[model samples]
Target chain A: MTRLLGLDPGLRFTGWGVIDAIGNRLRHVADGVIATDGELPVPDRLRVLHDALVGLFSTYAPEEAAVEETYVNRNGSSTLKLGYARGVALLAPALHDIPVSEYGAMAVKRAVVGTGAATKEQVEMMVRRLLPGAVIRRADASDALAVAICHAHHRTSALKVATGTRMA
Target chain B: MTRLLGLDPGLRFTGWGVIDAIGNRLRHVADGVIATDGELPVPDRLRVLHDALVGLFSTYAPEEAAVEETYVNRNGSSTLKLGYARGVALLAPALHDIPVSEYGAMAVKRAVVGTGAATKEQVEMMVRRLLPGAVIRRADASDALAVAICHAHHRTSALKVATGTRMA
Candidate 1:
């Protein structure tokens, strides 16, 4: 069994989800959002996000991690701020010696909902069906869960290929 | 006497300089650049930068720090990458509980060369004059040193004002 953590990073809200994967079976463990105070200075806000992730790593103790790659926006300033948060999200897992995998949004959507152009609602519905009774609090948290599910699916397929099993 | 560290953050090169400030006198201690491997993955590169800064903080143990504020670029992707480095730079000092101050490029140039519009060569010349016999390694390192000198000057002026002494 391998435990995985998925992160959807943003400047104001960083969502995280944890799951355990064994072959094709997956179980949701936990999920939540790390919200930083926007009124604080950029550095202080980044620190807040970093410390929160550090705390989460201590509590969850995932063996591996995955992150949704950022999509650069048209607004340069906004993209820059998002990158700052993404840096913290990536760094925390790495500091814990957890190997991280990144998946683009289209890849994640296809993996989770079987469609690269799936809408947000479609992804959320799939997540709910995949992990029954998961109380996803916010869209960010749900997005994080979707990323975790995607990783679980990808890892399972890779394992099958490595073992000379039929590609599922 | 106060020990200060200054940083010029970039995705490819992060420059750092340490100095000791006593009243109106400033002396350079050390300066170097943390150059990340561009070929590596983004998260791995960010981890490399973060670890380097943490090592510097441990080695120098500066009481305070200053960083050149990031100027957003027209290219969103480039600006985002720069933000990742800046995030690491800012987080390191704050993680050490060292107070961090930010200065715009114009402010730093004005402080070091008495002109906000000073050219790069002019700033370099002033840094060489201020720290005589100092071996400047790279442009990034010199820029970091210039920021340190700027902070030292500003701090001294602030101290004098706080003590009710005439501004120098």
Candidate 2:
């Protein structure tokens, strides 16, 4: 079984979910958000995010990690804030020597819900169906699960291709 | 004397400078850049930057840290890229429990060169004169030193204010 950690990073709230993937099967392990206070300075806020992520890594010990590749937002400042949190999300996993992969939002949706334009509800519903008893409440956590599922699918397909090549 | 570390963060090369501030006097301690490979994935690159910074914090053991408050870049992608590196720059010191300060470019120029409109050469010349042998070669290291100087000035003034308050 391959343990995976998925992260959806934001300055205000960074949502995360963990799952285990063995071949095509995925099992929900955990999901939640790491929130930082708005009143704190950016450095302090980033430290909060960083510390929480490091804690999660130690608790779950996920073998691999996945993060959603954010699209360019129209608002420059918000995008920059997101970038700060996303940096921690990516860095925390790499710091622990876990390989990190990124998936676009579209790819995550297609992998989880069978469509690129699936609504949040659709994604959440499928997240439940695929990983039974996944107690995802927030949109951010559900989205994180979606990305983890996407990684699982991609990794499984890559493994298949490798095996096929070896056989050939 | 208070030891200070100042950082000017970039994805390609993060410039760092260390200085010691004693009342109105400043002494340059060390200066260098941390460069990451462009071909590496962002997470791995961030790890390289993070590791270099962690090493600096241990070596310098700075009591306080300062980072330049950057103006927004017009290009969206570039701004986001900068945000990622800046995040690490700010977080590293904070993680090490160092008090981190920020100064605008104008404030740094004013403190270092006695004018907000000081040219780059003027700032570099003043940094050398103020520190009395700061061997600054790169523009990035000079800017980092300038911010460190600005922090020294501000911190000195703040100390004076606190002293006055206590005396009163």
Candidate 3:
């Protein structure tokens, strides 16, 4: 079984989900959002995010990780702040020596819900169906779970290709 | 005397300069650039930058820090990448519990060279003059020194105001 951590990075709230993948089965391990105070300075906010992630990594010890890649936003400042949060997300896993893979948001939606243009509600519904009793409390956490499930599928397929085995 | 670290962040190269601020004198302690390999994946590149910065923080043990605030670039992607580097730069100091200050590019230039619109070459020349006998290296490092100098001036004035004293 491969334990994976998935992150949906944002400046104010970074959502994370952990799952254990065994063959084609994925079981939810945990999920939560690390929220930083908007009133804090940017450096302090980043510190809060980074420290929370470091604690999470120490607790979960996930073998591998995945992140949802950020797209350009209309607001330049917002995009830059998102990039800052993404940097912390990527850095945390790397610091733990966990290899990370990134999937575009559209790709994550497509893999989880079979459509690139799936709405948040559609994706959330599919995530609940895929991970029964997941108790997803927030949209950001749901998105993170979707990313984990998507990576689980991708990794399984890659494994099948490497072993020259047909999908069971 | 306050030991200050200043940073100029970029995706490929993060420049850092250390200086000791004593009364009205500024003495250079160290300056260098941390370069990340361009061919590496984004996560790995971030890891490289983060680890290098952690090491610098351990070595220098600066009491305070200043960073050049990133300006939005014409290219959104480029600006995002720069934010990633800036995030790491800001994070390292915060991790060390160092008080951080931000200076705009123009503000730093004005503080160091008496002109907000001073050219890079002019800033570099002034940095060399300010820290005579210092082997000024890359343009990025020079810019970092300028940021340090800028912070030193601002801090001194603020200290004077708080203490109700004239400039020494």
Candidate 3, A1-168: lDDT as tens digits: 999998999989899999999889889999999999999988899999999999988998899999888888777888788888888888898888899999998889999999999998999999999888789898889888899999999998898897886543
Candidate 3 accuracy as lDDT:
0.89
The DockQ-based CAPRI class assigned to model 2 is medium
Report the lDDT of model 3 for residue A36.
Answer: 96
- Candidate 3 Cα outliers beyond 4 Å, as residue runs: A165-168, B165-168
Residue pairs of candidate 1 with colliding backbone atoms: none
Model 1 alpha-carbon drift over 4 Å, by segment? A165-168, B164-168
In candidate 2, position B82 carries an lDDT of: 83
Interface residue Cα RMSD of candidate 1 after superposition = 1.2
Pairs that collide in candidate 3 are none
lDDT of 1 by residue, A83-163 (tens): 889888888887888888989999999998999999999999998889887898799998998888888989988877878
TM-score of 2: 0.96
Candidate 1 has a DockQ of 0.74
Give me candidate 1's TM-score against the actual structure.
Answer: 0.94
| Model 3, C-alpha of A74: deviation from truth (Å) | 2.4
Q: Summing lDDT over every window of 10 consecutive residues in candidate 3 chain A, give the lowest-scoring window.
A: A159-168
Where is model 2 chain A poorest over a 10-residue stretch in terms of lDDT? A71-80
Candidate 2 lDDT, tens digit per residue, A6-111?
Answer: 9988889988999999767889999998889999999999999999999999999999999998887777787788778888788999899999999999999999
